[model samples]
Target: MTRLRTLLVLLVLWCGVAASALAGPIYRVTVDTAALAGQGGYLDFLFLGLQDAAPATATLSNFTGALEGGGVTAGDASGSGAGRVILGNGSGWNEFAQHVGFGGLFGFDVTFEVGGAAGDSGTNLTLALLDDAFQYVGAAGDIVTFALLPGQADGVTTDGNFATVQAVPEPGSVALLALGLLGMAVLRRRSR
Candidate 1:
């Protein structure tokens, strides 16, 4: 009986420890499109794992005009319709937080300069975080996604970037934990 009780206690403690250790933090994802142009095309922003603590902001670091090469469609049928523009070289920064029970939140702010001759010069930015499969993980896995609008503000902006707390357990780990608990229970019953 004493041995069974000890096993039970150990099982419970293990579960608690696993739960706490698997707990992830909250993240905020944002996208800014202040330097992009509508004529040159739009830009897509992607984020992996972002925390959702506070002060979620996405800052645009650099912007370069699209490239000109052969086999390029003059008017591509893309989402923006301003034609496809390849990014030269740019960098940006994003920040967020992580907490227990809460998934994460993220924000992004991007700026784009419209092409001077296109007459469709505006910024189009989008901020988002996606998993390995590119699936939108609003409140599940560790990914965030952001979308920016053209001709919009040139600074950081917040949107409906909130996710619920999700606690997903691994199949193997859960099975092991359950088996351990069940073993303790069975032992207790046999001893009694």
Candidate 2:
């Protein structure tokens, strides 16, 4: 009976530790496109790539994005590569006039998972607005390059240009800590 109890306690402790350590951090990246709304074209492409990132230290995965404000109507597509995410809207070959009439201040909300050591940091990604031909709009601030550091918020903005990196709070670690304490208490009581 004592051996069974000990094994059970050990199992609980291991589980608690595993749960807390295996979960990675989630970041919320927001991009505002208010500046290019009336620039004679609709927002066609939003690219999050590692073109200028520190590939050795930075890691990102599990991407999800959404369009906001009064500008998002119809026609949207998305895809992901090894370390990049591509979002598109409107017809191709149309140049930078996809949503010329649908011009309205809008923003993009992107959430992704990241993993890196405490000191691991740098520009991990860049957010770019491109035309149907995948050419960047010939305007300032159309390309916002930023980093998503652990436990820190980051942003780059210009002419309504904005990007915020916010970490999603996780309670698993706290719950695991509590579980560990409870297991320890029970084990002590049994020993006594």
Candidate 3:
């Protein structure tokens, strides 16, 4: 009877651990506009568009954006397509306007998750930078393509060029995990 009780408790704890780890994949794409500065001195607009092809079980959501230096999302450019421009307007071409001054950083991140029992075998996402007229501006290296396979432990691939794409833990979750680890370490030390 005692052995059966111990097994039941272990099973419950194992299930709790697995349930806590269950979640979709998160990716962070940080664009170094500074490297593309030679292509243009002023980044009038950043094309925050994504072209993706994913497994039927996979879906994308929770898109977030940030900017360094100066710029704003042009409402007109908020959609999925090759011509979408999510950054500054035509006025940004001039030195006086609010724009990412070539040397600034533009960040775009997305979450990919498996919505069905089939699971996400793989997914591809493409990101780009565009001009005021919604024309492609960056060079080959500046443009990045990410291939994510949720099935794998570390399932993110890229050309590894000028652009930066990485998997990051959610800030709140990471903080909580750090606190838990510290508490465990303190308890272990006290027991010793």
TM-score of each: 0.24, 0.42, 0.48
Looking at model 1, residue 34 earns an lDDT score of 28
- Judged by TM-score, which candidate is best? 3
Sort order, lDDT high to low: 2, 3, 1
**What ranking emerges by TM-score with the best candidate at the front?**
3, 2, 1
Candidate 3 per-residue C-alpha lDDT over 83-155 given as tens digits, one digit per residue, 9 for 90 to 100: 2223212221211112343555655455544322224344333455655554656654336554444455434
Q: How high is the CA lDDT of each candidate model?
A: 0.33, 0.44, 0.44
Residue-level lDDT of model 2, residues 90-179, one tens digit each, is 222111112332234333334434444444543333444655454666454354444455445554443334445556655677777788
Better of 2 and 3 by TM-score: 3
Question: Between candidates 1 and 2, which one is better according to lDDT?
Answer: 2
Could you tell me how far off, in angstroms, the CA of residue 115 lies in candidate 2 after the best superposition? 9.8
Candidate 3, residue 64: Cα displacement in angstroms equals 8.9
Superposed by TM-score, candidate 2 places the C-alpha of residue 12 at a distance from the truth, in angstroms, of 3.1
Error of 1 at 99 (Å): 32
